[model samples]
Structures are given as C-alpha cells and as structure tokens.
Target chain A: MNKRVGKQTIETPSKPRIIATASIVGPKEGEGPLKDYFDIILEDDLNGKDTYEKAESSMMYTAVNEVIKKANFKEENIDYLLAGDLLNQLTSACFAAKDMDIPFIGLFGACSTMTESLAMGSLMIDGGYANHVIAATSSHFSSAERQFRFPLEYGSQRPPTAQWTVTGSGAMLLGREGNFPYISYVTMGKVKDYGVNDVNNMGEAMAPAAVDTIAQHLRDTGRTPDYYDIIATGDLGKVGKRITKELLLEHGFELKDNYIDCGDEIFEHERQKTNSGGSGCGCSAVVDCGYIYKNMLNGKFKRVLLVSTGALLSSTSCFQGLNIPGIAHAVAVEI
Target chain B: MNKRVGKQTIETPSKPRIIATASIVGPKEGEGPLKDYFDIILEDDLNGKDTYEKAESSMMYTAVNEVIKKANFKEENIDYLLAGDLLNQLTSACFAAKDMDIPFIGLFGACSTMTESLAMGSLMIDGGYANHVIAATSSHFSSAERQFRFPLEYGSQRPPTAQWTVTGSGAMLLGREGNFPYISYVTMGKVKDYGVNDVNNMGEAMAPAAVDTIAQHLRDTGRTPDYYDIIATGDLGKVGKRITKELLLEHGFELKDNYIDCGDEIFEHERQKTNSGGSGCGCSAVVDCGYIYKNMLNGKFKRVLLVSTGALLSSTSCFQGLNIPGIAHAVAVEI
Candidate 1:
C-alpha cells in the first residue's frame, strides 16, 4: 500500500488492481472515427436523438467487451461486474452488466460514478477479494434532457454555465498488479456548494467544487503539480478549467503545463454547441476508456492524475433554489 | 469465504459472505416506513406544493439520517458507502452522500439497485476488501411519479398492474462477520425480456425478469426451496409474486415451509391498500432493512433468499417502441 502524504494516507490493495480500461461512443460524437469497439449505431427515425439509457448502454457494452478482450478472458472468468449510468435505475449499466453474464453489481453517483467505481473496485483488489473486477459508466443527451431538463423537442435557451450532456461511456478492468500501470492513489472530491442557484451554467456552479477537490488532494498529498505529468478533471470545460486554474493560483500553487479537463478533451472534435463544456459520467469515462488508455498504452504520458467530478443536484432541488453541490475524485496512475 | 453446496471450492480470502437478497415495494410509493426512522414526512401545505426534487431531497435527507442512526454507525467509521436512488444523474443520492461527508460510491439499479448494491458490497466483504460497507437505496412517489408517469397531483386512474411506491429508504452493513446473519451467496439476475408489452403495471413488465433470475440462481447452485426458510423477491408485488411462484413450480420446485415475498410482506398490515403489492428498489430495501434485519438479529429466520428484481425500460423507451428488459439479483443470508 502507498504511504500517506498529508493528513490521511490513501491505501490501494496489493492484491486486486485495475489492469485495463476501455470505452466506446457514437461515431459522430466519438473523438475519432475508428476509435470505437463496435460500429456506431444511430437510428434513422430518431434524428440526432438518443436516449440516455441507449447512449450509455451501447458504450458500456463496448467498454466491458474491450476490458474482457484486453485481459484475454471469456465471459465466465469474471467473478463480478460493477456498473452504473445516468438513469433513474442505472438501467444502462446494470442491463449491460447483466447481458455480459458476469455476476453484476450496479451503482450511481451521477457524473462521478466512474471514479467511485474505481475506488470500490480498487479497494476490492487491494483487499484480495478477487483477481479481476470491472467498473463502467455511461450517459446520453436525449434521455437526460427529457428526464432532467425538458421534453425531447423543447427548445429552451441554455444558460452560459449550462453544460452539454456527454453522449458516451467508459469501462475498466482491475487485477493483481503485474505488467500494467496501477492506481497509486484515489481521493474523493468533497461536496462543496457555493450556494450558486443557477444551474443553467454548471461549470461556474461546479468550479468551486472541482477547485476544492483538487486543492484538498494537493494538501492531502503535499504534492505540487510537478508530481504528475497531467491532472485531468472529469468534465469542467474551458470556462470551468480556467476558473480552477485561477483558484489554484489564488491558493499559492500553479498547474500551468498540463492541468487539462477530460470533458473538454473528449468534446474537442465533436463540438456540440455549448458555452462552457460537457458534463456527465461519460466525460471522464470516454476519455479514460478511449484517449487516455491509448496514450498510456502507447507510452505517451506517465504518472497522470484523473480527477472526475460530479454535480449533486436534482430537478426538484434545482426548482427549490437549492445550490448545486459538486464532488470530484482523483486517481493517480504511473506508467 | 463461505463455501456453497456442491463445489467445496474455497475462496482465496476467507471470510463471511453476502448472499441471497430481496427488495420489494409496498403501498406507500417508493419504500415502506421504518419503525425507528421517523414517519414519512407527509407532504402538507408547507411542503405539499414542493416539486418532485424538493420532496425527494427532504425525504431522502430524513431517511438517510434514520438509516445511519439505525445502523449504529458514526459517519466517519463507514469505510465506503454504496447508495443509489431513482433520479436523473442520481442527484438525490449524490447530494446526500456528499453532505454525509462519508466517502461514498453512488450507484443506480432502478428498483433492483438494492440487490445490486448488496451484491457488490457482499463481494467486497467476500473478496476481503472491506470490513464494513453500507448498501442503501430509496425512492419517492412524487419523484418517480412525476418523472415516469404523471405529476404528483395528476390523480390519474391507476392500472391493475401498477404497483404502489413505498416512500422509504433501506440500508444494511456488510462485514466479515457479525452477531446477526451474514450474506451467504450472491447469484446475479440476468437481463431477460419476455416481450411483455404491458407498461401501465410494472408487475407485468418485471415479473419475467424476477422469475428468470430466481430460476437461474437455483439452477446454478443446485439448491432446492427446502434449503431456505424463505424465498423472497424484491418488488414483484402480489401479481408478480404469484406468477413467480407458478413459474418456480413449473420448474419442479416448491418452497414449501418458508417462502415469503417482500412486496407481500410489507403490505401484511394493510392488505387492501397494498392491493397487488409493492414495487420499487426501496420496496424490498425498506422491508429488508426495517423488518428482515431485526428478525435475523433476533434469530427468527435462519436461511433466506432475497431476490430483487428490476424492469430496465424507461417511459421514453416505451414511447420509442422498445421492449422493457428486466433483471434481478439474489443474495442469501444465514444466521
């Protein structure tokens, strides 16, 4: 187990560790054309419309398959599967986990699910429960829009801080440490509510939470930005990332070289009109399962910090003028 | 880890395990009332006009507090939390988990989340990852009703198969071993679509999934109904339970002395009101947490099978002409 740096030490299992991770999404929404496991499927009758469940499930299905293939295993070898998505019942993640035929466990943490899954899965491996564990998450715009915001056809003006729903999914595999890089550390994002009432622009509303989590990780680890090659937040696009940078400077620390955000990275190519950035579990997941995995495998970047974030507020709470509480988790991996 | 009937196969990390579980709904909306937890915060004039999110936040806040207190746990000692509720992005669960200041991993399994959480948490203990993991789930009538079917005040006519939501929350602790019983074996429920076209009543929609999972569990373990004191399902309600019983008999098994369904259990007080039975993750959860936990601690029942079921289709999917797929998970606990 890794030693503590600051107030409390974070320990990962010596037994069970995540060995591989993967993800997939629609062709048009994907970062690249061929960087997907299965062919991108879009139904004709539903123009530019996809259910959060479908978008989430299809990608999750692909991710699970990728992790399985990477490990060179069949369906039954996996003892259990843990998954969740941006649905009321975690249908996409759970349903996909079920079909995959692994003993399945489901979870939901809104956009922060991927990190949470990693934490649980990592702990499992550390504790020596099993040799392998899989975690995944996904989301879609069509499903979330109607359920959380408005009807599918409703054309409401989005607030500048409002983030576009990420249309994607990501998956990972954990096993005994051997050849692959291991998750050295994980810190959960503290729930910070600046009491900002306007969720139309989530980046501004969530910036403080992201900042707090990063700051805490730094304080807890007693490490500066030089400790890793890059620090990537789950979502938080340009505006949010800028605010985070500004906040970091205010605290007497700076991360100028590569303090990037995952949502901004994933949506860089498939720019769906949005003021701030993309937000969802898929933001980090897609990037992790896709770009991040490829890069790490290709020996592009070593020692990276992936801090996924989530906004904890529902439609009812939003309607009641409750402030959005944001949380993030930092996962450190070294090549 | 505990060994099953036939294999005599041993687990790597030896300890108690989480097995056969159940979740079922009663009349109250999402989950049933807990004896120790405060009475459901009835929506009155002050909160009556609250939005789905508002009522949900309030109820969730109250329920979580009660769950923590009842579990006799100080928030800090909780190594990790597994929680999920029915809402877009799991806003309610996230908000609560954040405020609790307990590092948590949120999850979503729709109504089957209770079982899913149990399965994952149990695996953690069985695999030697944790000594304590709390699995919790909740649902609210206003929240679910508004999101899927109608507004809280819609007062629409009820369908025959529409199971009542049991406005409640259920939580339990998974550990290496306890004075009370421990989760014995966890059998995952598969995503089975029986092609049932009925949507108005969830019993019709989810019955097949429950049956399939329970059948698979028995088949996989090679155990018979005579092995357990009870064979309970999460929230199939009266209608769904009846169908499940019929299916089980058709499979040449009879749970003669000790087979009671959770949905049917909660409604024993007000049979007429419960009508068919409970439906929702909280349905089975509340029963398990409020009723079953106490009984097991008191040594009323020894061996039991808890199978929580879920229908993985959403209102939009139904409208989109997609069939509702369902899943169930069974965890057995022995005192």
Candidate 2:
C-alpha cells in the first residue's frame, strides 16, 4: 500500500529579506537564571500581578527598545514589529512595542519566538512587502514562574530532567539585506502525540515528538545530520536527549557527534544543576542569538539547523487530563 | 554618503508548501464591529478575562480551541503551534496552545497578529520545514479594556478614534496546495515613525505608519491598488482613513474604487456613536477569514490585499506620556 506523505506545493513569489538579528540577556549568562540579560530585576519577590507583570514587561521592553536603538536604521525603516514572549499576551514584547514611537506586529512561539518572528518577517521581505522587520522574545523566571509554574518564591524543586527558562531577551534584525542569515531553509515538524501520558516527566512526553520532527527534516531535505555543523533541537531535556539519540539510530541514522540541544548546552554546569537543560523562549533564543549566531560569524559552524521545540499544554489542560503534544520548526542557517 | 538598499535573497531548489489556516467569527459578511460575527448578546457581565489573570488567556483559549475544532486537523498533524495575543507573556495564546497537545511557537504583532501568523506559517510551509502550522490571536472587550484602558465595566465614553476589539476568532488552512486562496505575497510596512504625538487617538497616530508602508509596497511591488479587487487596511478608523487616502494620492496612486479599511467597514453602522473603528488582532482577521476570503472565492474579488493595521502601544507607555505609533502588513490572497 502506498501511503501519502502529506505534502502540498504552491508558487509563492516571496523572499523575506532579513534586515538584522539582535539579542540581550541578563548580566550573567548562566550564572543566575534571572540575571541572563534583564535590565530590571526582581529580588526574589513573588508578588502577583503587582511585580511579575512589570518584570516580564520590562525585560522584553528593554530588549526590543535596545535593538531599535542600536539598529542605526531609523525606526521609520522598520515596516512591522514581530515579537513574542514566554508569557501570556506576549505583554512584554507587545507592550514594549506599543510604547515605542514605531508601530508593530507581535507573535508568540514559546522559546522559538525569535525564529517564528523571523520566519514571518522573512515572508514579508520575500513577498516584496516591507524592507525591514524586527523579531523579538524574552523569558524571565519571576514572570514565567508565576505564569507557567509556581510563583517566584514557590521554591518548587525541578526534576533532573526539568529545564530552566533563561533570563534573557533576543531580537533579530531582518532587512531587505544585512548581516543576518537569509533564512536559507525552514522545515516544520508535524505535531506528534507521543502518548507518553506523563505530564510530570516532560522528557518522556516530548522526546518522541522531537525525534519525529528531526527525522522528518532529514528525510525531507534529503540531507544527513552530517550536513549540518550543528543540528540543534529547541529544548529536549536529558531523557528526551537519550530517546532522541536512540530513535535517530533506530532509523538507521546516527548524529552522536555534532547534534546539540540548546537546553543541554546552555545549562551544562553543575551549578545550574539543570541535569537536562534550559528551556523557554529565551533558552534556545539566547543560544541562537548569543552563542550560535556568534559561532556562525566566527566560521565555527558552516551550516546549522535550528529546531526549536514547543510543548502544547496548559495548566487547565493538565487539570482537564490531556497529554503533551510537541512540534518543532527547523531553520537552516548557512554561511 | 550613499544610502544603498540591500537585498535579502531566498534561493531554493524547489517551491515550498503551505499546511493550513483557520478563522472564526459572528457574521459572514458586512462588518459591524463585535455584533456582526460573534453571537454576542451584550451582557453587563460580558468580560474578556474572569480576573486580570484570565482576561487574555481565556480569550486566546477560546480562539485557539475554536480553530482546532474547525480545522479538524488533528493536533498530531500540527507540528508547530504559532499564536500571539495582547496580554503579557502572550498568556492567552500560549496558555491556549499549551493545552492542545501540539508543540507551540508564540507570536506578538499587537493588532497584526493574524496576518503575522499567516506570514510565518507560510514561510514554514514554503521552507518545507513543517507539514502544518497554526496561527491565531484574539481580543476580548473586557480583557483589553482592563489592560489598556479603564476597567471592563468602565462607563466612560470611548473616544471617536478608539476602535472596538472584535469579539471573535479566525483561522485558515494555508496548505501548499489547498483550495483556500494561497497566501501568495506578503509586503511588510516600513516601521515608519512619523512621530505622531497622540495617545488618546490611535487612528491619527497610526495613519502615517500605515501610509508609509502602504506607499512603499506600491513602490516595491510596482503595482497600483487597481491591481487588486479589494485594497484594505485593518483598523485605521475614519480619521486615519482619509489621510491614508490623501497620502496615496500624493504618491500618484489612488485606491478609490475597491479600497476599504477594516475599521471603517466593521464600524460602518456604529458611526453614530463610534470613536475609532474596530481594533485588536482579530479585526482584520475576522474580516479576512469571514468576508474577504468568501468574497474572493465567490468572484466578488480576485486578487486582494488584506492589509492588517496595528497600533503598537501599551497602558504603561501611555501612562508614562508616550505617543502612539502604528504599523500595517499586507497579505495577498489570490484565488
């Protein structure tokens, strides 16, 4: 029986010209979760909307404003503002854009926001619409804790497979032409329901979803993992990593050497105690903007596939008895 | 010094594909603010969020779930969940996507979210990264009011330039070869900062930003508004609309016949007591998915530019005495 691969083709005469890409983090990289690149800090205060809202808004607001300030390109050059955050309304990014003298368009892609925004921004550029696009997102412990998990002072112990949200902000400049990567290729993962049926252990829940998308990407592009200097998934913790490796090998493909997960690389130190890695829109973003982009500039990696992953689940859904489904999009960053 | 325009080129061996797009609303035709689409029985208790926390999330949850249900695309087939909303952290979109069991990528484009999502989803499809992508955003009167204006029950009269947030949802199936009009082109508006120093009136504040981008699009694509059956901008209200018209004429281009603004179209009947036109991410979205799309399919229109407008601003910024800026993105829907 011949099964359909579920593919469709259309002629889209669009070329998104990336104007630029930028990023910001707390004072220290991985030293403090909340200190990645935030200009404003919450001193362990777990205030409800009172503190969390401002902190979240402030960090994203700062990063976006800074990127705009540093662009050298007039704010008038920016055609649309595409931004997202780990928080609810994407308030920080949205509000920050709102406060600016320039107008905007916002987005939400969890830790993969920058990529999402860039993907869209590139569309506008490719389609011969606008010349400049700004994509941004932020993550904060104080803000994310209250929204995604517990309050800041809740002191919830994370499982070894658990990941940390980076206290950082990433912004990219995509113009008709600039130093930014031209979004060489993009591959989206099908939403996969691994049916792990374990919310408490996200690794088991999301690992298969990650593997399926990664494997599909290789198949679709007809390129081996060896083609990329780094084949990075957005965030898959320790257990997910174990499973991803195993699944890749089972499929007659091996990527033990150059395949790196953003979470694992960002929080590799014992001090972080993040046995799995760092997760969140900021996690993969910081690595992408701060680490990966820099590495590409230095010619350390020639071709890279950035696979940002997101888990679809909410507190209510968890309460309503739902399994975690995961999806990923792969962006090929080439020299 | 010579200012040179740069080029961001997209080179691919093959054409990229689209996965899907979805939309929901109250009425199918003729815009009339919130009353048209949603089965909105104006209740004194009608609120966007139950509390400040729930305001954004609940609205996003409603739209996301509605799209998921309507699309009938199983969550497992959805590789990437792209969403954005007006709340901080993109709470509603994020929270909504979190529960659906698909990996999520959040977005924030203030009012231009729906178009922004489409652009990104199209890129993922074109890039052949993922098989499917979901893009959505929502705004509730109660939710946005509390965050950006007075409380949900604020009896204060709205300003003429204050457009109502459509209490509805929209989604689309943007597959590579779907029957729906392909998101063939996307023209980004230049981030123009004409420095409109108005906070209370978004229409006037956003007019220049709209004109700047729209005019540039004509130049970039070298197509007159006559090239499209319908040339529409999202929510530029009555005041901004006239100026946009004037600006176009000044640029030797006029979209007199098929030109329309989502704000003017949605608030046509509400003129007696309207401040601005309709606002929020769903304004253009509801129109696109509901009226524009259907009209295009029915032969009332052929090539249409769904220009979604956005005012990037926040309550905090307004409180801090900052001016309101605007933006718009044009999505070409071809039959």
Candidate 3:
C-alpha cells in the first residue's frame, strides 16, 4: 500500500488514464518537423491579443478547451484544473483558469510545469479526490524573452548557446474511467544546483538535474534503460542532451540509445536557427502531448519515461548572483 | 468512495493530521499582538542577508527546518516539500528548498498559498502518496513591496486602503500517524473576477472570492456558520472582511460572530499603522500556524473553517490593464 518506492518515486497503483490531450503551437512551430501532430497552429504568435502575455493566455485557453472537446466532456465535468506557465505568478495559466470556471491550483516549476501538473493530476484522480482533472501549461517566445531576457523591440543578439523559447501550450485530461495510456509511476525531484549561473544557457543549467532524476527513477523503480521503450527529457537542448547522457553514463545507467530530448526533437537545428534548441514551459509540453502521446496511441511505444526538467532561477535571483537550481520530474506512462 | 461532497468540497474519509508547525516573523510582526505565538522572532528583518529577498529565503528556510525539528524528523523523513512565496518565480521557496535536498513542488496561489499547500499536502497523505509532507510559505514587506509596488528607496506614499505585506514564514508538517488536528475536507476554488483592477486595493478585489468559496463550502458540506467554532479567512484584511461578510449574508449565510480574518488578528490596525491591516502570503501563514494551530492544540477550538483568499493579478497584467481575478480555497480542520 505504500506507493512511495525508494527516495523520490511514487508507484501509482491505479494507473490513472490519460484520457485526452491537445497541443497548440505558434506559426514557427507549425513550420517545424512535428507540425502535423499538433491540434491547432496559430498563424501569429499574438493570436489576436495585444500583448504577448495575453497571447500566451489565449493559447492555454485554446488547448484546455480543445482537450476537453477531444475528450467529449463539458467544463463542468472537470473536477480540478492544475496549470502553470513560465510567466511571473503564472499569469497565462491563472488567466486561462479564471475563464474556465473550474477549481484551480496554480503550480510553478518553470519549464517542468507540464510534467508537474500531469503528475499532480494523476495523483488526484488515482487518489479518488477527483473524477477528472486537466493539467495544462503554456509559454510564448516574445513573452518569455521580454520577461526573462530583453525587450522584444531591443532586437539584441543572442549567443549560440541560447535556446529559443517555444510559443505554444499543451493540455492533458486525466480520468479514472478511461482505456487510454495510464501514468504508472511518478518521480519527484530535489533541487539540484551545479553552480551554473549563466541564464542564457538554461539547457546546460538544467542538464544535471535531469541526470539526477533519470538516474534516481531507474534506481528506485528497479528498472533498466531498456525497460522503457523511450526516455524523453524536457527542453535540454542539443548541448544539455550531451551532458545528460554523459552524466547518466557516469551514474552507471546507459540511457543514450533510447533517450531523446524534447528540445532537440522540436526543430531542425540547421535551418530553423534555434541555436541550441527550443526551451520553455511549452517546449516539452507540445512534444509530449503531440509526439509522444500520439505515438503511444499508435502502439509505437509500449512504455515511456517522460522527464520534464526546469531551471528554478528567477530574474531576481539571477540579478542577485544566485546559482541557478534545476529540477526534473519523471512520469512513467504505459499503454 | 466518492470523497467529493455537493459541488466543491472533498470530504476526506481518512483525515490527515497537522503533525507539527513552526512560524518565523520579522521585527515588525514580532512587535504585533501575536508575537508570543511565533517560534522564531528575528531581531531584524535582514537577518544577516544583504538583500530583502535573501532575508525572506532565510525566514522560509528557518521555518521549514524548525518545523522538521519540532516534529523530531530529519529532512530525509519528509517525502515532499510544497512551498511558495510572494517573490516572483517563488524565489524564497525555491531557494529554501534547494538547501533542504527534499523533493520539491513549488506552488503559486499568490496570498492563498498557505491553505493551498495545506490542502495539497493533506490530500497527498490521505491518498497514501506520502507519509510526511511539509507545506510552507513566506512573504517579506520589502521584497513584496519592491516586486508588486514601489522599491524600498522610492518611499512612495500609499493610499489608506493599501494593506501592509507581512514579513514572515510559516511551515507545517502534515502526516498520517500523528494525533494532531485532522484535515476533514478541502474546497478548491474557482477564480471569481468582479472586474476590480486596482492593484493597490487588493483586499477589495479579493473579497468576493472569499465570499464565493466560503458560501460554496458551507453549501456543499450542508453546514451553517455555527457548525464550526471559528471560520478564518486568510488575509482579506479589514476592507475585504467587511465586504466578504456582506456578500455572504446576501447569499443567505450570516457569518458574523464566529468568523475572523487572520489579517485582522496579526497587527493592531491603529497602533501598527498597517492602514487596512496585514495582507500577504505570510499574513495568514504565521497567523494560522502560530496562533490558530497553537490554540487548537490547547482544545480552544474543536472544528474550524480556514479560507485563504488570493488576488491573482501579476504586475504585468496590471500594467497591461487587465482586471484582477480572485480565488479562495477552504479547508475544514477538526481536533
């Protein structure tokens, strides 16, 4: 009955089903490789809103509505909506939830919010606290750049290590009475800081945390890399992916063969000019909901370990010369 | 098996206990009426930190560690740490959790974080997800003022309606094995916006939301105001408390005698010069942990309803001229 498996993993006994999922991306992402997998593609990042922040909120609202439509359920059917975004105070998610009229719990895990919400939603359903829960997150390129980096009008040049923030949103509905792929396990993560302070290279900053969670998951669950058909990490771009693989190998878990970073899969690096890769709350969100979830439905993957990584550094903390702490949450899904 | 009551409340069949708690307050709060109740009263708000942000982080760290110590448990004994603060990106909570090495889940409910964390932690325990969970939140007057209002050096004058943000942190350790006050039910709230846009008068903006959740909780549980010995609203302050009481009376529930606002209990309004009383993430946190929890332990109150209200408007949203939305989550506790 003790669902906690070693240090940081929770073994889900009920295996709460992921009933439906939907992803919405901006025009840039629509032109990317996995464009067809997305449910809605915006021709403009603004999405008819005046500010990029409102545009991000619109994307979240759209994704939540689309996922509910896909599940053929009414808004009243959702018992709780757990959501978060990269914006300060989670403006996008909170604004979106305000219109939904559902019970809301705002979360903040930076880019890892997608998986954090999913893990919490699964537990809510599995624990019989709710019949259905919607977990959603969003990020916007312009909004994030303005908030975390520089002003949009500044047109400042970025270094090659900088990862482009993805403009998109993803929502997943979890329910107890579904025959869809179910979340089998969830591994929570501790804050791990490797003393990296460069805000520009978030991929490198988050890499070690992903490594820690990945190794911890395998060790706690007593599973090898081969046990999972695919192990996907959130937003650890090309640079971080290499570091993650090395660290996992150092930790004695050879995770290279079956592992893939969501950021690396989002765009064609050479042509898209997404220097390192896509990075944000939305980077891994759209990939997981559009690519991985769809593939699982098609029987392309039997088991998957989706670890969403986050850099827990605020602009204030960066300004104060604090080290960037990173965290990664892993959820095991089986069809 | 259905834990959900009429509409919004979750009736926990397996009640979760508040095993131990600790509160740390700044110099100002230490001079307040509830001074004797707080565990740690700092001689100065800075507490040897250069920045007020780091000072808030130190307060959070001290409260979390003190709560663990009070419970006679090490950091490893805690399965998860759920924390938040008024700082952007939850800098206080994240920085505190980084040093603890516990699995962290950062939440953002603005000022409602105290009850939000308590609700989530209780569900985690009752659901058999974890045996022990720590819920903590903090807010510093200087840090919150700089982020949400004027900078410390600005020395801007505030309106009479403006409330002072409390400088303090509170942590509660929830477990399944303790004989502490049990969490009996939780009511997750829906965002309610009455089109109030003034960031300066957050109490007025959040009042309707506290009314909505309190009424929904009473309706769903089929209980009257007198069903509990006390009903405490988080940080509605004097302005919000008055509005909330009127709104609840309009909804056919006259909650005048037994209801109290935590914001009203902290500082003496006239003597402390906190115009509209205390209002922040820390306002209700220290009040609940230090005063209410201590009183409950002494058998002063058998049953209570704690509703923590929040105004979910970021500085960005306010700058963008968006209306403020409010939410209030309620928890039923019984000794």
Please give, for residues A1-335, the per-residue lDDT of candidate 3 as tens digits. 57888788998888899999999999999998999899999998899999999999999999999999999999999999999998988999989998988999999999999999999999998888899999999999999998988998999888888898999999999998767999999998889999999988998899998999989999999999999999999998999999999888899989756899889999988899899999999988999999999999999988999999999988999999999999999999999
List model 3 lDDT by residue over B147-261, tens digit each.
9888789898888888999999999999988688999999989898999998778888999989989999989999999999899998888888899999898999998678999
**Which candidate wins on lDDT?**
3
Please write out the lDDT profile of model 2 over residues B238-325, one tens digit for every residue: 7878888988788788868688887677655454355666767767776776667667666788788777777766555455454565
lDDT of 1 at B171: 68
Pairs of colliding residues, candidate 3: none
Q: What are the candidates' individual DockQ scores?
A: 0.31, 0.18, 0.84
Interface RMSD of 3: 0.9
Provide the lowest-lDDT 10-residue window in model 1 chain B.
Answer: B1-10
Assess candidate 1 and give its lDDT.
0.66
Residue B165 local lDDT, model 1:
64
Give the C-alpha interface root-mean-square deviation per candidate. 4.6, 8.7, 0.9
